[model samples]
Target chain A: MIQAVLTAEARTPGAARLHAALMELKYEFIRLMRTRAYSLSVLGFPLMFYLLFGIGQRSSAAAQYVIAGYSCFGLGSACLFGIGLGIAFERAQGWLELKWASPMPRLVYLAAKMAASATFALIVMGLLIGLGVTAGRAHVSLAQAAELAGILLVGSIPFTALGLLVALIAPPKAAAGIINLVYIPVSFASGFWMPMRMLPHWLQAAAPALPTYHLGRLALGVFGLASGKHALEHWLVLASCSVLMFAAAWITFVRSEAKSP
Target chain B: MSATAPAIPAAAPPAPLARLREVTKRYGQLAALDRFSLTLRRGEVTALLGPNGAGKTTAVRLLLGLTRPDAGAAEVLGRDPRSSAARTAIGAMLQVANAPDTLSVREQIELFRSYYPRPLATAELLNRTGLAALERQRFGTLSGGQKQRVLFALAICGDPEVVFLDEPTVGLDIQTRRQVWSEVRALAAAGKAVLLTTHYLEEADALAHRIVLIERGRVVRAGTPHEIKHSIAARRIRCRTRLTAAVLRELPTVTGVEADRDGVVIFAHEPEQVLREMLPLDETIGDLEVSAASLEDAFLALTHTS
Candidate 1:
């Protein structure tokens, strides 16, 4: 009986509907790819950071640390940039209302958005990893590289959720300001540009509460470059954040739909 | 088969396409719709007519299940508008101006088409809307009228049983507006029910089988165009006499008088009676004329709020 209900629901979405939803998602990604802001967020900063800290003739140990840290930073950048900024622009232009009026299922629309966001995050991570393997000349084993990729993927989840939360809370006109406020502080506090140990005690204490901090720490651990006892704790924090963000976004979606005229 | 045989095997009687029973929508201190009741029959064209803020758009939103009424019931195609089945049966075009800039006209059409179970042929719709030449052009690059045409295409692309067009041609030129009118008329001819709200009184006069005129959240008048016109007093009379605006305003039959660039428009109930009165004041008046009451006059007369 459970299977029958699920199938009945699933069967309602015909091939055309799925194709349409995916096409909308593809259109969204392609449009973002053309915008200067998305370009800067994904490629500009990561490349500059990689060159400034990960690639130069600075201290070898410092460079390796920068490499791992910036890789995680790249993942976070993709999430906040792709999901956060994209939704704000859509809301500002009344596109979300149009979508709501259409026959497109809410799940389908959100699933497409999440898929596109993940794809962009993966691309940014790949570029950073390529730089690490080729120019950084890091001694990461094949297992370590696989583990790092897996960790980066997991790290993307919480940031994406956070981006969705921002999309719900902020109006489109104020989206850029709100996102800047969110991304800057979160990025700095996570110690992406510096090591957590170097920060003050209070900041270090607060680092575990942030998704980006946990993700960065997880990336460093996977590269076999750090010695930290709280890996499990950080992992738990990221998992909990992902769940919360998803829940908040779901509530926002339902509320917005109920509002009319 | 006999000529009277039912086209599709008749089962149970299908419900009324849309029904609103004393529906009222209030926002804060403002009432957008007050006890507005309307029933749209299946496969019929019902035109919603009024000035801005007359609650026409509000009523459309209520029928689309976008807005909940403060009181009374609203249903579409036998289900509450918020229900899945009702949404599936209805399509709408609102007055929002922006679409995503990167999507080409073809892409936009194709995308909307995917959202419905049954869709019209894209090529045919494009040709009908005169957008075939600009198929590959991005939506944002098109002129305002072209964009509106694309929206019209999207609204009907679903081939929904009931379609709502709210001020679909707000800024289109004469030619484009007529083109949209034809498309709407064609939809009605094809057995699709349409609920249209438009500012162009002539558009309603030309297309709507039944008209509902709203004012300040209430249906002040509802009937056919002829009925509405007949409800108001007959022929309008005006003369470009030296009658001062204040003096003209005193006449009981003169409902309104306003200055235009060329001359003043004196709205009066009896053209012959008012014309006879004006002749003594301006015997040399070259602009004296009597004309039949138009839909615009009827609208002004019925919907004039203090």
Candidate 2:
């Protein structure tokens, strides 16, 4: 259904129309980068998490675990932080109507927004990799480092899609609360904040249900830790979750744009 | 009726470029546009005029396809606004200039220009909107009027076939406002349809080929400015006369009369004939003044009465 809608928007939509949508996307991207909220959340929380968990701890094993956890959790937050919240705010403040009135292709607008958010997610991954290897003393092989980068890049999809979906349904100010409600508790439940071995059996059983949990387990694998024989299952779960979130977000976004004033 | 009348067959009046057929947007129980219907044509400017809750914004929103009419259809360029094909023909400048504050005005225009496939030159946009010198200034640092010009620049960047401007001159100085008015006129002259919503009566009266007066979510009157001004048909006559109250009341055309320090003002349907009758009775009508009905007065009478 989503593909059909996008395809229809593209059928003979002139270069000028798609260009207009891309321009709106570029503006949205640059605007998000310059905002204090985006800068602080993107760069600040990861730094704070690194300090409180990795450096502040005494044990090397604890520090290593913290490195893995903070890298996964912080990158997840970064993916959703600005794009979702910013979109919600734009909707609340009535900027969406301006876009609706322009000679811009609506699908291209969403496509560009997703692209911008993915770019920011890449920046967050780079921050995590630099901080994890340098200051946190997490030793890594070359293959593992590459895998970790790949994990951050691939793992960003679900959250980015989720952020778009949340922005679709939530009000601007409420987006932060909604994202936190989804991210923090899910991170804790998924054993990203603590080792799954140390978690209760019920939590261990339910962790795989979350996209973030699968992502964290995958990250643990990059750190040379065993994510169990069901690691393939985790991969499938994350892929399916990402697809589902993308579909949901796309549907909600279209409906919201259709109804917006 | 000349034989050489261009053999044009009088090209039947162009179909309305836009029309709202019984459109209504309801937020729960509040009707933003209560069964509103309006028409706009190519190369013509139609002003949407109303007070705060009179549904002017709602009508604009519906026409832009930002909000769907709960009951009716809003057709722009002969297509639903929600459709991309329909939207390509539109250029709009809503209330706020919500571009990134960090981007320079030039960057902002360039960015917006990229959204359209064939955009106007950035320099031309800046010059047309009167932002030539301020092009390199950051968006946040620009004054409100300057930002508005940039927004206008963005609106016209694509050179759309139809333009919707909602209060485009709200914060502008007189000179800036005049410039925007000329731009609006120029757009129409170039054969683009223009729809504007303004609180300024003069803007509607001066720029719009037709004015749509909305009150409480319904269009109470829609016609040329002349027709709208004459909608109420209440012309005023002021005379500094010593005519007795009985004499003024005796005139059948005088609908109402009240005394001011300088004179007795009369509101009559036929002010010219009524004042002529009173001329012989009061030679001391030194400060006498007569003015035809105005759009402002017409608006007050229409909206305030109903």
| Model 1 segments more than 4 A misplaced | A1-17, A57-68, A139-154, A225-232, A242-261, B1-16, B241-269, B274-286
What are the models' TM-scores? 0.85, 0.82
Estimate every model's Cα lDDT from 0 to 1: 0.76, 0.76
What would the per-residue lDDT of candidate 1 be over residues A1-261, giving only the tens digit for each residue? 533432232234555455666666776677667666776677778778887767763555565667677767777777776777677677667666666677776677666666676667667666766776688755556776678777877676787788888888788778778777777777778887887788889998997777787777777777555667579988898888899989998899668745534
lDDT of 1 by residue, B1-306 (tens): 699897875764333578899998887778888899987766567899888878887788788776788899998877788777787788888876588777789888877876777677789878988999999998879999998999888888888888899888888999899888888888888777889898888989998888999998898889988898877766666556677788767766777776755567777776566666766776666676677778898898888841
TM-score values for chain B across all models: 0.85, 0.87
Clashes of 1: 0
lDDT of 2 by residue, B1-306 (tens): 697577646776555788899988877667778889988888899998887888888888888877778898999878998776677677889987355577889987776665554568877888898888898898889898898888889889978888889899988999999999999999999988899988898899999999988988998898999998876656877767888767897885875566767787676788878877887777777777778767876777678741
* Interface RMSD of the candidates, in order: 4.1, 4.9
Q: Candidate 2 on A165-243: residue-level lDDT in tens?
A: 8888887778898888878889898877788888899988887777888888887876656547567877898889879
Worst 10 residues of 1 chain B by lDDT: B8-17
State the DockQ of every prediction. Answer: 0.39, 0.39
